[model samples]
Target: MNALMLLVQKLSCDVEEHVFSEVSLAIEKPESYFEKFKERLDERGIDSPIDQLAWISLVDALLDHDLAFELDWKESGLYICDVVDELLDRKKMAYISWGDFEDEEFDELPTSQCLNEISGKLKEVGISLAYLDIDSDSYVLITVPSSDIDDIKKMAQEAGYSIQDSF
Candidate 1:
């Protein structure tokens, strides 16, 4: 699982070039970590296989957002929580998902106002704000850098919720 570990490490370390390069290489080489059918279709300029592009785009977005962190992620690992995940757990996060809302309807939602409201609410609970997606009506994810897990759990319990480990 070195490849998977490498991907996770790159993500945890916030190694931009290395991560992008690995993903690009994975796209090109068709490793066990990634499916190749989509890659092949991509190279042919066919539009049917979109998951490859979507996954790549998602990784790009994650890396873009990670640039905001002041600390080194490689040393930190994934022990720190992503801000969007926090908001989602609070039920204060919103996102456009087929399971919930459609893309067009989600686009019509008041995102800025919603983000502000969620931010304020999370702040009250001693949680920090991270990322919010208005167009998709989704919150990215957030985590306390050095906060106690017990305390965070307490806060979530107080809100009549529970926290789950994220992948």
Candidate 2:
């Protein structure tokens, strides 16, 4: 499904007006590949969504005590993992009317929707959340460049993903 792509519009300096940038994330693993990854979370006793495994992967990738400090969310009174939990809950409540979603809190969203919400929140710091498939085993995080390119690049590089200005 073309569900992994997000279209972003930009006012180009050279263009007549606007141009479209495709936010095509790269997740370089098969379904079975995640089982090993899930073990890491399981060892830590963290339960996350299955349908949106990509979302869980993002949470694992970005979860850090220093994240709130680096992102200036420390004073926002929540840890990165805490924000992630709240986001999952918000999605659950938002889709509580749907029988399928209501049946399971963690599985309340499609991957695209979850990624979109995370992207929106990241945008607050001039970063966009996405996956970049760097190898055959797992997904690596990436960002869409904005006014905060330097910080974004550092984060992506620290996460060990190649930086791309556009998809």
Index of the highest-TM-score prediction: 1
lDDT of 1 by residue, 59-100 (tens): 443444453222222222112223344324443434322222
Q: Which candidate's lDDT is highest?
A: 1
TM-scores of all models? 0.28, 0.26
The lDDT of each candidate is 0.38, 0.36
Find the 10 residues in a row with the least total lDDT in model 2: 16-25
Q: Which residue segments of model 2 deviate by more than 4 Å?
A: 1-107, 135-137, 142-145, 148-167
Please list the residue runs of candidate 1 whose C-alpha ends up more than 4 Å from where it truly belongs after superposition: 1-109, 132-167
- The alpha-carbon deviation from the true structure for residue 117 of candidate 2, after best TM-score superposition, in angstroms, is 1.6
Residue-level lDDT of model 2, residues 1-167, one tens digit each, is 22221111111122212121111121445244355565755754545434444434433433321111112211121222244334334323121122222234324544444445555655665544444433323323334345645544445455444333332
Could you tell me the TM-score of candidate 1? 0.28
On the 0 to 100 scale, the lDDT of residue 160 in model 2 is 48
Error of 2 at 58 (Å): 17
Evaluate candidate 1 by giving its C-alpha RMSD to the native, one decimal.
Answer: 15.3
